[model samples]
Target chain A: MAGIIMEIVQKGWPISRIKKFIYLGFLLVAAIFTVLYIVKTNPINYVSDKLPFTLGNEKPRFLFSIYGSGMNGGLSKPMDVTFVNDRIYITDTGNKRVQIFDRSGNSVGLFGKAGNKAGEFKFPYGITGDSEGLIYVSDMRNANISVFDRAGSFVKILADNKQLNKPGGLYISENRLYVSDIAESKVKVFDLNGKKLLEIGKAGRGKEELNSPNSVSVEGNRVYISDSGNDRVQVFDTEGKYINTLGFENNSKTSMFVNPRGIGVSGGRVFVASKVTSYVFALDQNGQKIFTLGGMGQEDENLALPNGMFIDEEGRIYIVDSANQRLVVYQN
Target chain B: MKLTRLSLILTLSLALVMAISTAAFAAQAIDSGPVKGDGRSDYAATPKNTTTTYPGGIYLEYDANGVAKDIHSNYQRNTDACASCHATHTAVGASLLQWANVTDTCNACHDGTITTTYDVVYGDFANGTRTYGGLFGGTTEGPNSLSKHNVGEVNIAAAPGGNSAGKADGFGSEWGKSFECSSCHTPHGQGRNFRILHPDVNGLATINRVKGETLTSPDNLVFSSLKAPWLYGRPYNSSNFSDSTHTAVYVNGVKQLTGFSIDYKTGKVTFTSPPTGTVTAWYVPSFKVTGDVANKLTANEKVTYKEGFNEFCGACHTDYAALTRGDGKRLTGVYQEAYRHAFGFNYSSGPNKKGLVFSNNAAKSMTNEFTCMTCHVAHGADQTWWTDWKTKSGWEGIVSGENAGSSALKRLPNMATCESCHEKGKGDYTY
Candidate 1:
């Protein structure tokens, strides 16, 4: 190749002509890159129409909504909802009661009332259920968790003010209950019998720390917490070991969360209800963005300060739209 | 020659790519449904994606159209703060509050779960940690004495100075209505008054004034056609102008500082010389302070009182409020010694040289006028010592009968609130 270039130089080729040829080659390569860049950065190409059920692109089908109080099946600031034994148990916070309903949007039977008695609730914020049809509620104002039987009867109370201060969200899995103490900014794990097992996180914006965590969900050996005030999600092992952090806007490719409240892990996706933005963000197990549900509005599709979320075995999402005073159901 | 042809081909390809990329950028600008899952659509709409951060780490995000998506405690337009107190669809109370009553709704956040700054029930730093509003429903004052304001009481009796026959407004008619938190504070944060105090309390409009005025004079010196009476010596408006300060005068959009003298009561402006351009004045119609002024002041700081507070209190207590110097001399129709104590007087340089508790120390000097808040607490008075003394046998001359040591929201209990400044019965008492 060097000998041929030397022979061509010896031949009568002009210097300006060689320079022109080199410039043409550079221009051709630049044009090809520009075409590729446009196609890569195009917004339409980011989400494909062909993949309809993709995490971020799929739209949830509205199932039904339950609202109102007493005979009208009404609720006042219903904070949390859970599915158990084919029935829905809602912590009717404003009325200071636990309202129960059937799957078809019918009021089944209700329990609890406004007081500090064995069954009453001051501010029931989070709710969860177990396989044997037992329900657990996080009474925020009373700073305790109230347990009730499947028949809407008072069973007992767990984790009073001594163990919890402003307990907000609850999750029950594998005979272990995970409770997020909002004031203390800690996640306390307890057995079904109200025995403290493991404690996770402290009040800070660090990696192993949480700031006003709202909800907790257990998927296998991992525990997912909505670190609300920090605007992120912290994942920990069942033994309370910090695994990873997600949803901080400062992290590249992550969406901004303002006061994330409710969280649920279902179908390999983690769903978080952002309180101030009124949107539910879905993320994959690896903390990659999947999709978002609803925005801030009064419409059927919109949500207002959604507090608690529940995902049943059937892949149906029950959102406690607290500010809207209703429970909105969506099919995944 | 071949190189030149190749160069032309390369240039054409570059132009083609540029054209297609421009079209693609424009096509991407289309709105893609509602939910912003991928962050692409959200980023496209809000290119900068700016956020306005408030106290307590509360922040609001503006949408693509530059409208605030959700507002928390800031209480600006299109606020989600409404949902904080009221549940629109499942309202359990009269004003769409999810709770059974207005006080319950206020107590929900004020109980210190959400914020300890405005804990009204336990009086935690609500007014700079002084418990200025007093405790609600507690045994601070003996076991039997409830001395606080009956906030949630239904069908209550008339106010002490309430006159239903004297004023035609709803102030007089509010006698039997359920006295609640909404009676004083407008929850939606609508009023220009301090602490979101309702501009129109009961039926009386406490603060009234022309917002903006263009002054015109034949000789270009005096302009006096103000539609309403302006608040004197109180900088309630944005311009912060009172009689002591000049009304915000603008000559052709430039602020004029020295050329005008304003008559606050008459709503008149007189200029020093003939002005060539158009003269305009911007002033608030009533003595309305920006909301939450007291929250910004320190505990020991004194708030300067000028005017308008008497009118604000007089809206409900019409017979007791002395609107003017002449009105202070008589007890309405009876013409006896003034039944009500004098207000709106500058007590800064009086026999009582010590300054009293004022409204806010934002601007202006401490005039120390005898506003209603000077001798009273807005919520309730919890003085256990005074309640114990009044219930005993020896305090008959000072206070007696069923109303004995009721406190009536008095600041210092018994006549000590009066004696602290007046020094008639005892020597000058300190706060």
Candidate 2:
């Protein structure tokens, strides 16, 4: 191949013309590097492989998955995931812990364990990292909310929360923490000090009521929940008003969402992670189906029993591809 | 300190390798399937309501593509225990119970006033956590009724964080009902327990058996499994209480602080919180559930005791779940061995203990492991939560008289309850 290239160069143009072409090639490479720098998240370890599930417009592009390859950080059944201050906090639940990562998919740090202590977590469920550099995790078995500083040092738990029953999904917005009480079927809003400011929803079959809600997310004043029991993502205002229902298929009874567990809201879209169906469903702000992200499989981008999800400021989606025991990232 | 240094060296090496690999594979554009979503602005809501035999009835609750739910097949096919409480043919009420309301349907079999076949007075529905007895299977009316749960016929409101459950004006009642059997018991059933309680850890659908999924086993934290209530026929029911330590600690935003280490020979933690801070108790990350002292329970057995039953009850009565009930970050709270006191296999009478325990053991069989039945009845009874015979403090229950309530002697409702197997302690006693 090198001899042929030399012959083609001799027959095609002079040495000076060839030098000009080489210069243009160098400029192209430089421009590509500049574009990468302009975009904050370019995926540290990128594999040029095709991801199965993506929207038709090629909006969501699959990035390198962080399944702890070489020394890239391993995860075991990570549940909920959150992004704050350019860091990813995942409830690396199977390890009875939490795993933190930087935007470039580097292992930043980790904390928690399997115990009934202040810093320990017995099955950490929903995890949220706030702008204040505080990380809050909902212990499913402990039935409490444990707060930790950015370094994962033990901060206080939510104060005297007799109302937090089977606390599952968590979110931090407007300096308040929103916790989904799986048993009580309500979203509890708490102040930064962990005092519950108010609650949203009741237990019923109504549109406004929730039955065993798991993950709760907030966009503006609207709160979205993976109403796992109801088999749909129920949207509501922060004040507990029923806004609309997302993922409502033609079959109103058993539509698209089989077991919606984790949810995320950003960039005019909603992403739902369901357990039984094992699909990360992307829906528009109006509760319309945008695209389904994954299916039940062991392949790359195919998710099995996905738990939690986080969308970065640049529209990059980080999924706790839970049962697959890996953290998957995608871009649009 | 040695292990910390080793880990630091290892981490740094790993980081260096990762950085090199990252540099090689850097700047690749994401390539995959089509761009997502239906961009249509107009959408219609066409409700698909199918016709079934039972009018206005929601039979086959929350069916997942005809997937057989876990609780549905927990028992044998012939043993249709659901018929014991609900009757589809001779229905008498909305929920199809034998009686018009839950308060009456439960009282008919519980109050001991109905028929001799099922004689037991659980007291009024509106009664709180206080107990009542002298009927069928409870503490007698005299002293045993010290502190019974109140489930009387009064208007019950939603508990804190409670939705419209068991409220008089909630699901089934408009004029307001009283203390109800449905308030605590999920009669439809979720587990082996007769009255399905709240926070049934087994109620969720586990990823271990999702349809068409390759994950044949459950991972810790059950990320793949989905948690639902009995109302949805939940399937994913498992905990993260594994035998492996797998504990990771971070302080001051760093993984494994530099100033802490564990002496392997002594199994003790040595820590000096540097300016960056350090983790506490990561040396013994978890209690060893294997070993002669731990009864050599298998992984499944260990989970039921260590993480299951306590969490089930903690769903509602959150305060009684933990040993210390400490809510402070500064304090260290430890969970006790729930089985040794309740349904576990280590409840033999201790030496130097009260004679009441000995006599009760002699009269009845105290060989059974601890369970909710060991100390309290399934329904409501006359025993307070903390008034049980053992100490409340964690790691302090082995020796008696350590805390204020450790030595208090209490009895279950039926004379045959705790008194049937455990005698009252005169002074300080151990279980």
Most TM-score-accurate candidate: 1
Task: Go through the candidates in order and give each one's DockQ.
Answer: 0.05, 0.04
iRMS, candidate 2, in Å: value is 19.3
Residue range A139-236, candidate 1, lDDT tens digits: 87677998889888888887798998878888988779999988788899999888999899997767888866878988667888988756678999
Candidate 1 wrongly placed segments (more than 4 Å): A1-56, A68-73, A249-255, A286-289, B1-279, B285-431
Q: What does candidate 1's lDDT look like per residue over B389-424, in tens digits?
A: 343333434432224546676655556566557768
- Two-chain complex of model 2, DockQ on C-alpha atoms against the true structure: 0.04
Please give the lDDT score at residue B347 for candidate 2: 59
Cα lDDT tens digits, model 2, A1-332, are: 44534444344445465567669889997887787666532332121112333333234668867774345447765778888767788887656788777888788788877666777775688888776788888886567998888878888887433756668888887788898887677889998887778988887656777766878888667888887666678888877778888766543443466557777754556788765556677776556566677755557867756778877666778888765678888885
TM-score of 2: 0.43
Q: Where does model 2 exceed 4 Å of error? A: A1-59, A68-74, B1-431
Model 2 lDDT per residue over B1-431, tens place: 54345445545666698898886445333443444322111223222323421111122233232212322221121122233335566766555654333443343223321111122343221111222121221222223333333344433333211122443221122223343556544444432232234222211212112222121121211111121111221111112333122222334334443455433223233446433343322212111111011211111111122223333433333333423333233332222212222232335654322212111122135432343323443343333322332222221223222132221223322332333445443656665
What is the lDDT for B373 in model 1?
A: 75
Interface RMSD of 1: 14.6
